[model samples]
Target: MAAGLAVTLATMTMGACSGERSEFDTRNESFLNDASPDAPAPGPGCGHQCSLDGRSVINTCTGETVQTCAADLACGAGVCQPPCAAAAADKSSNGCDFYFQEPRFEYTTISQSCYAAYVVNTSMQPVEVSMELEGKPLDLSRALYRAEPGSAEMTPLVGPIPPGESAILFISDKSPDTPLTPLESAYLGCPEGVVPASYVGGTPWGTGYGVAFHLTTNAPVSLAAVFPFGGASSAYSSATLLLPVPTWAKQHMIVNAWEMFRDGFGPGAQIFAAEDDTEVTIVPSRPIQSGKGVTGAPARVPVTYHLDKGQLLQIAQNEELTGSLVSSTKPTAIVGGHACANVPTHVTTCDVLAQQIPALEQWGHEYVGVGYAPRMGGEDELMMYRIIAARDGTRLDYDPALPAGAPVTMSAGEHVSFPAGVGEAFVVRTQDADHPIYLAAYMPGHGAAGGIWTGSDGRGDPDFVNVVPAGQYMSSYSFYADPTFADTSLVLVRAKTNGEFKDVSLECAGTLTDWKPVGTRGDYEFTRVILSRNYRPGDSFDGGGTCQYGLQRTKSDGPFTATIWGTAYCVSYGYTGGMALRKLVEIPLDVPH
Candidate 1:
C-alpha cells in the first residue's frame, strides 16, 4: 500500500491582479451588499452613484439612478463614491474575489468545445462547498470535466485582491482515454487532497489538455475566479488542458526503451539516462531500423527528438551493443524490462506483471524467496504465513485448515515452538505450493510449498526432526566423509524402522564447527546447515527438491557443511513421505550482472 502511493502530478495557476481594500471576513467567504429605500434624493452636485467596492454606478441627474441604484447603493451611505468617478477607475484596479463552485455543463459550440458554469461569491467571505443530488451526498469526484489549456494553476480568493475585483473560472472535458475509475471517484469524494483553482470569468475553452488551476491560501491574499466557456470530450486530440509548473517544483520526464530507440533519445529519455547530472545534447547518428529484422552493431549511436526542460534543449549520445538491440520508443513507465545474473554463469529475464485486473489501477513486481520450517503438529498446525506481502498492506497467509476471517493478531516478539510429540512436515517433488493451515496457537494465511520431482512424493517427521524407523530398532551412529565435494548429508545408525527412519546424504570438506539443533534430542534434532563459501546478494540454488527461494553458501574457515538427520517416515514411505528433516537456512546470493 505505501509502496504504490499516488503523487500529485501537476499544479494550476490563476491570473494575477492588483489588491484593493475591503471590509469582509477575507477568509474563504464572500462580500455582501444592501440598499436603503427611505434615503432621500441625491444631494446637490452628485452626478452619479457608485457602490462602495466600486463595481457599478448610477447617474442621478440622468434618471439612470432609478435603474442601476440596486448595484450602485448596496451597503453604504447614499453618498458613498460617485458612479461617474468609479467608472473612471480601471477595472483591474478594483479588487474582486473568486472561488470554485459547481462544475455543471454549459452550452457547447459546434466544434464540440464545452462551456461550463461556476459560481463565485464576490461578497468578501469564505464559503464551504457542499452539494447534494436528490438530497443524497453527490459523489462528483468522477464528474467528467477538464479545464482548458493553461488553466492548471489556482490562487486564493480571500486575501490581497483589491475590493470589487473579479477572477476567472475554466472547465472542460479532458483525459478521455483514462476515464475516472470508481476508486479514484471515491478518493476525490473524500476531498483530502483537493486544491483550489482560479481562472478568468468567461474565458473561452479549448479542446486539448494543458494546465488547469484553482485558488487557495494559508493567509489573507486577494484573488478572483475564471469560468471558461467550453467543456467537451472528443476522440481526436486537441489543446484542452495545459498545466503550468511552479518555479519551486521539480519536474521529471518518464521514458521507455522503445521510445528512446525510435524517437532518437528525446529530451525525456536523455534526462533519465544521462550520468554525472550533466546537461544532455542528443544528435542523429544513423537512420534507425523500423522492421523486426533490423539490428545495430555495438557502438556509439546518435539520435534526436524535440523537447526541452528548464528552458534548455536536452541532447546526448548513448553506447549501444550489437545483437542486444532494444525498443526505440516507450511509455513514461515500463511494466518490466530488466534482467539479473544466475549461478553457473547465466542470465535470466524478469517480467513485472499486474497482479490484479485493469493494469492501470494496480501494478507490482515478483521475486522468489526461500522458506524453511522444521515440523508441524499440535499448535504448529494452526500457524498461518505468507512468503510475500500484498500491495494492500496485508499479508496473504494461506492455510488449508483455517477459515478466512479477520486477521489473527500475534503477540509482539513471540513465536510458537513445538516442544515434543510434533515433527517437521515438508512437501517435496515440487517447488511451488500455496496453502493455509491452522497451528493450534495461530490462524491461517497464504504460504507456498512443493516443486521438486514432478511425480515423486515427499515425507516429514511425525514425531521428531530426523528420526528414522520409529517402530524398529538400530544400534550405531557415525559421521563419514562426504561423497559430493560441496554437498552435505544426514546419516543415522542403529535407528528404528517404523517409528522414525530416513536415509539422508551427508557431505562436507572441512572441520565440523558451529552446529546447533532445535530440540533436546541434541545431535538428532533439526539444526541449520552451514557451508564455507562467499556468496553474492541474488545467488540461488535449486537444492533439487530439498530447497528453494534464495540459497547461498557462506564463506567460513573450514570446508565442512552441517545438516540435520532424516525422519522415520522417509525410511517407511520413501521420497513420497516428504522431507523428514527441516532447518531454518540462510544463504548468501551472488551480485547481479
Candidate 2:
C-alpha cells in the first residue's frame, strides 16, 4: 500500500548516566557474592547495552529501549530507570524480562502471483525451526489439485529459523494435495537455480500463518524449511489470501502482489476476477521489520479462516467438500468500488447506483469531453450527443447517432447532463446505451424552453429557460439563471463517445407573455428527502437548478450503525467552497436523532 513518509521519533537522547551503580549490578552483587550461574558473554550480534541507575538498558536493533533490572525494577517506556521491585511475586519483573520477542505479521490476502511467505524476526533471537503450512478437515498431507482446471495448490513451508527470516513455499500440480491452489507459484514460477525447501503444515488456517518451529537462540539458523515431498509440474497455480486484516488492528494495510518470473518476461497479468472461487484469506500479524525488535517473528496464534475464493473452479472445489460456497465464506467485502458495491446486501449498504455505472466501478472508463464548436448565435445545428460503454477492450454498447469521440466513464450510478438543445433529449430509460437522455424543465420553463433531456431514471441536464434563440434581448436573462446560455452550441463533439457540449441553443418558439417562473427562482429550495431511514435496494435521489450541492445522507464509520445520517454540509457543497445563502438547501434534521 502507498503511504506518506513516516516521521521517525528522535532517538532517546542519551542523558548522562547517573554515576550510581546501575540497577542490574547493584542488586545482583549480593546474590553473586554467593556465586550462581555466571552471566554469559553477550552474543556477537547483541545490541548496545548500558547500565542506568541499577538497571540494564539494552538498545535493540530498532532503537527501542529494553530495561532489565536485577530481579526488582520494571521496564518503563523502554528504560530501566526505576526503583527495584523487592518481592518475587510481582508481575513487573516478568514484564520485560523476555530475552527475545516474536515477529509481527501484517496479515494480508494472498497475492495474485505470490504464496504466503511470512516474515520471521531472526535477529538477536534464536529461530531454528521454520514455519509450515497446515490444513484442517480437508487433509492437505499432499498438495491438492484445485478444482480450477490446471491450477495447483500453493501452501507455505517453514524451515530452520534465525534472525531476519523470510521465505515462500511453492506447491505445484505435481506436489501432493494441500489446501490452497498453486496460482501463486504458476505466476511467480520456480527459481532458475537451487533454493532450499522446508516442511509443510496441514492445518486449515495453517495455509496462511503456517506452523513455525522455533530455533534455538544459540545455534546457527538454516535458511530453508523441510518439504516432505518434491516433484515436477503440469500446470500453474496461485495462492489464496484473506480479504482484510483482523477487526482489532487500527491502521489499514494492503498487500500488493506482482508477477516475477525467471527472465522477468511478460507484463503484469490480469490478477483480479469477480467470481467467488478466487477468493483468498488474509491473516494479520504485527508488521515485520527486519533487525527491529522481535516483531518479524512468525507468530503461532489462533486465527479465523473462512474460505472466500472468486475463481469459479476453486469455488466449486471448495464447495464440493466444504459444502455450499456461501457456507464456507466470511461476511467481508472487497475494497475495490465494484467489489465493495457487490458485498451481500445483508452485510452493508451497497451502493445500488454505483453498481449501475461502470465508470464508478472501474477507473479505465472515463468521462471525456470531445469536439466543441462554439455557436456564434445559431450557426451550428443538430448538436450531436452520445454515450459509449466499453469494457475489456470491447464496446459493450453505444449511442448510434453520437459522432466519434472520447468516453465519459463514470461510476455506475453517476449522472451527467448536457444543456438543452445540445441535441434531442436522451433519457436514460434503462442501463442500455441506446436509451435517450432524460430532460426535465419546470413550469414557465415548460415545453421546449422548459424542456429537459434525461434518462427514465429521472437524471438529466438542467432544463432550458429564457432562450434568446435567435432574435431576443440578452439583458432579460440571468446568465446565472439559464447558465447553459453561456455554454454556446457545442461543448463537445466526437465520434463514438459519451461527450456533450456545455453551451447550446434551445428550441423554443413560445411568446414572452406565456413564460412563468419555475417554482421560486432562488438558490434556496425546500430540500426533500426520501427513504431517509430505510432505502429500498435501488432507490436514489437527485436535485438540479440553482442548487450546487445536492441532497446527500451523512456517511457513517460503519454500515447500519448510523445514529444519524442526513444532509450535513458547509456554506458550499460538502463544506469546501465559500458560497452562502440566507435560505440554503436543508433536509429534515429529524433523522431519528
Candidate 3:
C-alpha cells in the first residue's frame, strides 16, 4: 500500500512545482544526490552544495553549475539553493473545506462568545475567509482573537486578508439576552446583534447544530476555532485544527480525550456535510444521546442518517466516544471532543477539548511524541498520549519503549494510552503502511485532587492537540500564538541530522537552537521555545495585523511538525502548528447496500 501510494504521489507531484503553487499536489520528488555517479567529484570547498531549485543539482544558475557545489560554496537566491530548501517542500495545512463546532456551554457564559480564531493566509496572494451555514454564506466575521467582549469590534470580515498572516473572526455570541439599550452590553461575551439573529449555537444537547467555514483561496492556508469559555480561574479554553476539504474522508474513527464531565460538557462527535443528501453511518463505542434519531440504537451497532449541505449531526453521550466508527457516503467533516474534560476524569480541573478527526487516509504508521515544557513546579510534568488503531492487529514498536503498561498492539477501533515525562519522547511505528493509526497528545491539569487552583499558584489546566504524522511534516509554517495566552510555547520534532544544522528559526525569536534528541532514539530530536510571557494584544506584533493573526512564521531545513500551546490561570489552548495534509490511502466508500 505504501509503495503504491508513493508511486501515485510521485506521479501527482511531477508538474505541480514552479509558479504559484496550488493548495494540493504540492509534493516534489527529491532529486537531491540524483546526479550521475559517474560525474567527477568536486574539489575542496564543495560542502555547501547548491541547486537551481530545491530537489536536483542538475540545473544551471548564471554560468554556475547548480550541482554538488562545483565552484562557489553557494549561488545567489532562487539561482542555486540548498537541496530540499525549496519552500515547495513544505507540507503545510493549506486547503479549503473546514469544519468547526463550538461545544455547548451555558448559553449566557463566555463560551458562547466564540470566534474563528487564527485563520492563517499562508499564500503570497491575499485570501478571503467566510462562514457558511445551511449551505449559504453568512455575512459575519471579524479580526480579533482576544478582543474585549462587547466592544463591537468583532464584525463581519471587512476585506481580503493579507498574505502570510492570520485573522480572527467573531463566530457568534449565542446569548439571546444580549443587551440592546443603544449598545447595552449583556453579561455574556458578545452582543446578540453582533452575530446573525437566526444562527443560534450553544443550544441544548440532542439539538444537533452545524456550522462550517469556506475559505475563498486556492493558496495554502490553515484555520482553527478558539472556544475560550469564561475568564480567569476554572475557565475552559481549547482549540482544534480545521482540516481542509481535501483531507476530509468518507470514514473516520472517533477519539475523545476521556469520559465527559457530569452535568457539564461530555464526549461527543460533530459531523458536517458538504454535499446534500449525504448518508452517514455511525457505530458508537458509547451510547449516543437517545434522540435526534438515536433513541433506539445501542453501542457497537451502526446507526445511519441523512444530512444536507452545511448541516451538522452532533452525537453527544455520557461516555467517551473513542473507538467509535463513523463512515459517510460523501466527503464529510467530523470533529470529536469534550466541551470540558479532565484527563483521567479526575485531574485537578477541566478544560474544553476539540480536534478535527483526520480522514483515514491521513492516519500515519510512524509518529514522534514529546511532552510539553516543564510546569511551574520545576518538575517536567508527564503528558498523556493516545493512539487509535484504524486496522486490526496493528502492531506497534516504540523506540526507547513506553513506561510500564503501554500497548504494543491495537485492534481496529482500539485505543492505547500512556504518560510521557518531560524530555521523554516516543517514536512509534506500526507494522506496515496497511496498519495506520491516529495519535493525540494531551496535557493533564496541574494536579489531581487537592491541588491548588488559586490564581497565584495553579498553572495549566487540561489541554489537547493532535499528533500529526511524520509523513505529514511540513518544512515551514505560518501560524499564530494568541497574545491573550500567558505562556505561549512551541514543541516540535525533526530528523536528528537536521537538528545538527540548527536551522529552525522563529519570526520574532530568531533562530532556534539546542535540539535534544528524543530518548535514546537516534532517528529524531525535539525542542521547545517560549514565544512570549503574559502575551498582551499589541504588546508584541510582527508589524502586520490586518486580520492576519500574530503572523509568526517558523521554518526549517527539512520536514518537521510543531505544536503550539498556551497555558495560564487554569486555562490552556493547543493545536497542531501546521501540516502538509498528505493523504496516504484510498478507501472506496461502500454506502449502505
lDDT by residue (31-95, candidate 3, tens digit) is: 12211212223444233332422223433213244454322222222234321122222223555
* TM, every model: 0.16, 0.20, 0.75
Cα lDDT for residue 61, model 3? 19
Off by over 4 Å in 3: 1-92, 105-111, 141-158, 175-199, 202-204, 207-215, 229-234, 263-265, 293-296, 377-379, 448-456, 496-502, 536-549, 586-593
lDDT rank, highest first? 3, 1, 2
Per-residue error (Å), model 3, residue 66: 13
* Candidates sorted on TM-score, descending: 3, 2, 1
List, residue by residue over 65-134, the lDDT tens digit for candidate 2: 4655544342322333332111111111111111110110111211122122222221233333322222
Which candidate has the top score in TM-score? 3
Q: Model 1 TM-score?
A: 0.16
Superposition error at 572 for model 2 (Å): 42
lDDT of 3 at 301: 76
Per-candidate Cα RMSD to the true structure, in Å, reads: 33.1, 29.8, 11.8
Per-structure clash totals for the candidates: 170, 125, 9
Which prediction has more favorable lDDT, 1 or 3? 3
